[model samples]
Target: MKGISENMYCSDCGKKVKDGADICFNCGKEIPRGINKYITAENLPEEYKPISMWGYFGYQILFAIPIIGWIILIVYAIGGAPNINVRNFARSYFCFYIIAATLLLIVYLS
Candidate 1:
């Protein structure tokens, strides 16, 4: 009967979790050794720090503009962006734009 635990405990909330579970059902927090590797602030590299909230908002505002926004989007989407996160965001943004345009066109034609 040794090493035959029926359940596990959440380290943060001390709530009981099912054995072999990757998240705490009660707290909804990812358990250690879960599907996604948890990265803490201390573990983050100096160069990989996330952009400030204001900076992200500014990017959003800039992206909402017309001609300049398109130019910036193209630059970011086409590998000219230096930050990987920004590049990925730009690519996804373009994908969203294309999908939205297609949907609108379909609706208009119908």
Candidate 2:
């Protein structure tokens, strides 16, 4: 009901479409139903919820520390973390560190 309107419009050509219609009369494009819409965390299935601000910052802080930070990153990146979001974040963060370290090494060796 949120994305639906009294008179639906074809997203491709912006032509008015009739209710319960599958295809646009003017454009002949299929009228999208419950698709091509932004799905927020609230709309997502129960297994996933958007990461909280504090949890994000906490991971950032953990990654900032030396030695133990790398260990934690490796653990999470390897799927030790229960949350998919956290696992992905850790993997990306570890990749960033690896790239940064490689760049520094290249500069130092040069």
Candidate 3:
């Protein structure tokens, strides 16, 4: 017969938890006695993954393009993109452009 360690069980709901998880996703509770460690990942979740340095540089270059880059930036900023990080970046960049353009217009008018 096999025996299960108490650490293997969830503290809140007493359910079996996945090994090395920081929290019991199965029962939505913290692991007992902090036995669970943060699991290192070889590949992070796609949407959660950060944009690479080159990717940012590429995006900057893309946004410099006459028409297509602007379209892509606007679409992503308005939630057209599936990835939240990309959307956030797009929104931030769009805001920067808007601010710059507004400042330019103010300066021109003044």
Q: Order the numbered candidates by lDDT, best leading.
A: 2, 3, 1
Q: Please provide, for model 1 over 14-98, each residue's C-alpha lDDT reduced to its tens digit, 9 standing for 90 to 100.
A: 8987655667889888776642234457544444667778867777777778999979988988988767767777888889889
In model 1, what is the error at residue 55, expressed in angstroms? Answer: 1.7
Model 1 lDDT at residue 82: 68
RMSD of 3: 8.1
lDDT leader? 2
In model 2, the runs with Cα more than 4 Å from the true position are 1-47
Error of 1 at 39 (Å): 12
All-Cα superposition RMSD per candidate? 11.4, 10.7, 8.1
Better structure of 1 and 3 per TM-score = 3
CA error at residue 97 for candidate 2, angstroms: 0.6
lDDT values for all models = 0.74, 0.77, 0.76
Deviating ranges (above 4 Å) for candidate 1: 1-47
User: Tens digits of per-residue lDDT for model 2 on 1-110?
Assistant: 46433455688888876665666788789856565343444445333566899989999999889999888889989988778898899999998998999999999999
Ranking by TM-score: 3, 2, 1
